[model samples]
Target: MISTVVWGTGNVGRAAIRAVDAHPALKLTAVLVHNPDKVGRDAGQLCGLTHELGITATDDIDAVLAAGPTAVVYAASGDIRPDEALADITRAISAGAVVVTPALYPLYDQRNAPPEFRDPVLAAVADGGGSLFVSGVDPGWGNDVLPLLISGLGTTIDAIRCQEIFDYSTYDQEDSVRYLVGMGQPMDYQPLMLVETVPTMVWGGQIRLMARALGVQLDEIRETSDRRPLDATVSTRTMGEFAAGTQGAVRFEVQGIVQGEPRIVIEHVTRIHPSCAPDWPAPPGGGDGAHRVVIEGRPRIEVTVEATDEGENRSAGGNATAVGRLVGAIDWLVGAEPGLYDALDIPLRPAVGKLGRKQS
Candidate 1:
């Protein structure tokens, strides 16, 4: 079994702990946390499991690395503290632990990933013989694997579009929903996520990756967005009190142009309230959320994936899938030569091994 460590204890981190414990080929060794209160807690408690795993959460990074873990699942949020997250991943890789994370945004498509971020990771891998893989939902399987896989079913292809439609009220991330994404904010408030070039910086790589896979040259990448305000005051279960006229919903598209036409598209329909945008595309059966891929071509295929966590929470379910993708890759990364890898380089099938089966 590959001895593994899970770093961070937030949404993704909690999911990682559960995934590592349940996987047959992986051994849960340690959990790392930054919060002092979380230190010394059982990994199970952090993840809401009934029983405890033997592993305890630690703040001492050097101690954990010195213990000789084969892989480290870096689930820490790089959304706000990106520099620190990169440093943490770099340190782990340089200490000889294979690192997989959804944290490093640019590395989602390593080929187009910026040199400043990519260079250090490569040097660290060469120096310490560790491998790295970076991926997540929108830029992860939702675009790279799912879209391409569906396109194969069509006799001919005209356009491929991947969409994430969700209601964010149930999502517990107040910071991201309120501030970063500008939900429940004034109409004039510009979210950091939708700001100029930020979308390109974050998701443009997915466009490039898909175009490369389809053997199409993109003329350019373009971003467009629309926002709506809450019609009336509304209160959510977790994030309470969104006043009327505040930003309630957002829809955006990142398009990849091929031969002067947009052929590869990534779209997001995120709403704080269900009633905010009645006309926008929604999850089937009015479900909380889903990831969809539409191949607008011969046979005209469309696929939707819905996932739920322990409490039927779609947000948690999405996080769990991201965690699975990273954790399940541990064994393969351990066996492979040291290098930085993208979703295009990794196989989707191996990551499904030893999953949802009784542990031996």
Candidate 2:
């Protein structure tokens, strides 16, 4: 079994722990945390499980690395702390641990990643002969493999649009929703996630990755955004409150122009309240969130993926799926060449063997 450590204890981190424990080919060796209070707690308890996994959470990164796990599932939030997240992942790679994560956005498409972010990861892989795979819902299966696979069924394709439509009130990440995304902030407030060139930096790679997979080159990439304000004061179960006229919903698209038309697109329609943007697209089945793939082509294919955790938490469910995708690849990555790999390089079947072994 491959010894693995799950770093971070956020939504994704918790899901990673569950995934690692459930995988027959993986052994949950350690869980690294940044919060002091979380240290010394059982891994299972940290993830809301009733039983213990016999592994304790630790805040010491050096100590976990010293254990020399074969792999590290870095699930830390890189949105607000990109530098630290990059350093943590690179160090793991340099320590000869195959690192897989959804943290680093730039590394999502390593082929087109900037030198500043790509060079260090490549160097670390070369120095320690370890591999790295970065993927998630957006830069991950949602945009790359899912769309490409659907396109194969089409006799003629006109456009491919990947969308993530969700209500963020159930999502418990306060810092991300309030600060990074400006959920309750005024319309004039600039969110870090949707800032100039940031959307391109985040989802643009996915556009390029998909274009490359489909054997097409984009003429150019473009970004468009629209925001809606709350019609009235509203309260959420997790987040406190949002006053009227504040930013409540956001819709944006990252388009890959081909043949002078926006052929490949990644669109996000996110709202803190369901009533905020009734005109915008909603998730199928009227769920809290979903990842959708729409192909405007001969076959006219449409695919929607909804994730729900044990408690019907859509946000956690989405996070768990992302974690599963990353952890399920550990076995494959262990035997593969040591280098930066994209979703196209890793088959969608990595989760095949682990399917039947899912924990109840």
Candidate 3:
């Protein structure tokens, strides 16, 4: 049944077209939208998806690739414009489809990309025979595939630290306060603006996919940032309505090394005002919007992930666990393995449902 389209209606392209309109092996088949006031309309009410699935919304990318969809998720516009979004993902993989993207910085850190945009997206997915995968949820699963799947339960690992503290006070205020915490005024300020190189253009490919799955080989990559303010006002019903102390709080740290030794460290903290960390305290049975993973020496491991939601949307628990792991990796990104894959080559199991399920 494959047949999917879903380009961009925003917010992970309307949650990946309501997860391909409630996947049953998938088939929503169209909804492009470059915003001519939301093209033709109902892609389930331009993504409120309350009922109808007649599938509308189009800006005509050759009539939605001649209405022949086998794959195309490209959740457009995260801003950095990786060469005009890899030239629209190489024209939707040369019109044959099969392209999945979360587009925030091409392939994260594909060997410090810029070989004119990673050799033309790896020669347009090998001359568009098709197949491409990129993940989400913080460099696709809290810094590259959950630290290579916790170093496969370790044999003799040394380091890997990933932490993502949340509470953006229910994001969306122009994408969490004017493009992710830049907030108002100051000539659209800049200073570690969400950690320079723009959050490593979205996870510096999770530090080169954890140095190519722990084989470890890296020479350079460094970034650091910290900001605190929001000592008061922060509100969100739909990422707006602020008052208390205005808003401002952002932190990012990414460190990955091999030859010089620091293994990996990725940290992202966003707080538009929410506290608890009287200087590092809540361990030993963590809770309250918790997401933690710490692995250091041999036989030492700790993982605490708790954030679930269903209704009155209090930041719907990190957008339903980052849109249910990017909608269950859309059928293994339509038979993956082309070039560039993260979230540890994608396999957290339970895609359309399961894995902390709650979205009916």
- List of clashing residue pairs for candidate 1: none
Where's the lowest-lDDT run of ten residues in candidate 3? 276-285
User: What lDDT tens digits, residue by residue, belong to model 1 across residues 278-327?
Assistant: 99999998878889999998989999998898689887888888777777
List candidate 1 segments past 4 Å from native.
Answer: 350-360
Native-referenced Cα lDDT, model 3: 0.65
Q: What is the lDDT of residue 86 in candidate 2?
A: 90
Between candidates 2 and 3, which one is better according to TM-score?
2
Q: Order the numbered candidates by TM-score, best leading.
A: 2, 1, 3
Candidate 3 lDDT tens digits, 1-360: 788887887766776777677766778888888879898888887667557788778798887877667788888865645677888877777666677776746565565556776677677777766666666644256566666687789778787878776655555436545554665323335643564577666666777777777777877667787555444454555656445434355566777766787668777666554542224323223332455667888898877666545343334455556665766676776776565454555688754443463334
lDDT of 1: 0.88
Model 2 / residue 5 / CA error / Å: 0.4
lDDT comparing candidate 2 with the true structure: 0.89
Q: Model 3, which residues run further than 4 Å from truth?
A: 1-6, 9-31, 34-58, 67-73, 76-95, 102-129, 132-134, 149-161, 167-170, 173-238, 242-271, 274-294, 298-360
Q: Which pairs clash (backbone N, Cα, C closer than 3 Å) in model 3?
A: 108-205, 109-205, 145-344, 173-239, 232-245, 233-244, 233-245, 328-351
Q: Candidate 1's error at 354, in angstroms?
A: 4.0
TM-score to native of every candidate shown: 0.97, 0.97, 0.32
Against the true structure, candidate 1 reaches a TM-score of: 0.97
lDDT values of the candidates? 0.88, 0.89, 0.65
